[model samples]
Target chain A: MTDLEAGREALLDHVEALIAQRGGVSITLAELAAAAGMSPANLYRFFENKEALYEAVAERWFAPKVRAMEEVLASDLPIRQKFYAFYARRLGMICDDYARDPALFRSYLELGQQHIEIVRGFIDLADHFLAELIAEAIAEGYFPGLEIDSAVSLVNLMLQTFCDPELVVMLIHSVSEEKLAIVVDTIFDGLRGDRPSNVRRLTRAAR
Target chain B: MTDLEAGREALLDHVEALIAQRGGVSITLAELAAAAGMSPANLYRFFENKEALYEAVAERWFAPKVRAMEEVLASDLPIRQKFYAFYARRLGMICDDYARDPALFRSYLELGQQHIEIVRGFIDLADHFLAELIAEAIAEGYFPGLEIDSAVSLVNLMLQTFCDPELVVMLIHSVSEEKLAIVVDTIFDGLRGDRPSNVRRLTRAAR
Candidate 1:
């Protein structure tokens, strides 16, 4: 990378470390510069303002998560196993963030909506990955008599409590480890229910 | 009611109307007095400050809803039908609030957390009602092979997106009429899945 590019990247890294320590409030140019062992004026050379700096920090925060999730989606594991592994990784990441720095994680999530477009992009990207898995699950005859669209939204609702940082931060205590596993199981059971082997639930839609 | 009691009730009623008209911002002593055809000093006879007045307003807002919900819970409708009716009523009320006064609804929800104890109490009450239906559904052979505790939280997760005003405000368009019905169907199908007729998904907890 060019010197300027490297300096910009280093600045983003420093900002993230600071946020992990102090949440969103510490992103002032002076603090970031101090964290980087430089003057605020020098930091200004790399970024225009706090918002620009925050945008970069957000992209950095989301990069590895997106990559890991995409990897899980693209794998050839049986659909059920794939879904379990994906959420396991996601739940682990959230717990680690909260444990490592509860204050930062909470405040960041509270203010996270300020980066709405970025967060939306991540959710959209994750949704696209999950959509692929849902299609495969249906094709495998796992979700019999279910429309793909409905299944997609159902998965979104089922996973929202686990995946949304804002909700996670809010209900972190209420959603326990055992509860997560059980909800995942229920969703899978519901997805895989009503084959020739299981009892049939008369469709309310049909009624 | 005594003459003073009648005056207090009138202020609370006036406060609700104004909040529904202008949101939490309208609860200021001056605006409330102006809205109620009384002096600001006289208003202090009833409420100490905005916070106190808001707590009362919040309670008043939740009381009838809670009563109606308790009535729904007390009814002997079959579990499946009961669940549907409760959410339908809740969703309809929320949609009406959003439609009737989008600004007030938004502001109220934004400041809604200020009355955290009252809101939490309402949620706990509603949860108690839903818990009974969940237990009944399990007993009625509707949710075959599902744990009660897990089922309760699953029900909460499933209904949260559809009912949370904050989420509704954020994802109102994303959750369309057709999708809501379909998701509700999926939950039911999953509930009824894995009976003697279907090959049961072995409990993951066992594994």
Candidate 2:
């Protein structure tokens, strides 16, 4: 990478480190500059302010996960397996992230709400993929009555405790993948097709 | 009623009116006293502090609702209708309350979070009734594999958006009974006995 790209990389890394260490987005620009051994002016050259910097961090850190989820949706796995795979990856990653630095994950969530537009963009991306998956599930027989958007709404509502950052923070101590799996299973059961003979899709194509 | 009792009742009504008018729980005890034609010390004679007064409001305003839910639970209404009645009452009341005074409802949630013990007690009461309703559904045929607690967990998770006080505040402008009914129906469809012929309950008494 060029010298400018390298500097940008270092700045972003410092931003993450500072948020993790400070437990919130309340950290000062000066503190961030100090963490990176750079001047505030240099940081300003890279980002207009904290919101801009956070946007960049989200792009670097969270965007790839959304892309990966899209790939999961496009995979050759059955519908159930595709969902299970997506859940497993996310559940593991969130648990590990929380275990490594509980405060940082929380700070990220608080920052997302504070910078809601950036966060909503990220959520919309995730929602797009889930909407596709929900559509396929409906075609396959589950949620016979729901259109894609309504099904997505149900998923959002059902998983609010785990998916919502603020709610996650409130219930983190009691959260577990086992419990989450049960929830997923229950929703799928409820969504299961009541009429198998009318199934539209021949295979649960991942793609 | 005795004069002292009458005075306390008047003070509580004024508290509610002030909160509705002020659009928040940030109203001062002194202001509440003035609204009620009493001094702060006189207000203290009825209740020790603001939290205590809020607790009283919760008892008078909220506890009766919880008891009413219990009555619904014990009623011979179909499992589905019991869930429906509970959902309808809560969704209607919340929408009306939020529409009437958004800030007070938000402040109520904040206070509940701050005074978690009181909130927890309230939640437990609600959950106890939901648990019984879920158990009856399971015994009657729906949710074949779910135990009472697990089914209640799903109910809590699924209805969280429409039911959570804080979440309701966040979504109040967008909320409608139609959308809420969709959610309630979706959950009931999922909870509808997978094996209908084995249904044990026959009555769906409204009372």
TM-score of each: 0.81, 0.81
Q: What is chain B's TM-score across the candidates, in the order shown?
A: 0.75, 0.76
Backbone atom clashes (below 3 Å) for every candidate: 8, 4
How large is the i-RMS for each model, in angstroms?
6.9, 11.7
Query: Over the stretch B1-207, how does candidate 2's per-residue lDDT look in tens digits?
Result: 998778777887787777667554466688888888877887888888877777777776686577668777767666666776676577777778777866777767665666678678778888887887777777777777667876687677667777777887676664555555555555655543233211111111111
**TM-score (C-alpha) between model 1 and the true structure:** 0.81
lDDT (tens digit, per residue) of candidate 1 on B49-113: 88778777777666766776777788776555567666766776777778887887887786677
Q: Give model 2's DockQ, 2 decimals.
A: 0.19
C-alpha lDDT values of all predictions: 0.71, 0.68
Specify the poorest-scoring 10-residue window by lDDT in model 1 chain B. Answer: B197-206
Q: What RMSD value applies to candidate 2?
A: 9.1
Best lDDT among the predictions, by candidate number:
1
Question: Per-residue lDDT of A134-187 in model 2, one digit per residue for the tens?
Answer: 888787887776678867876777676766657666766655555565555556
- Model 2's alpha-carbon lDDT is 0.68
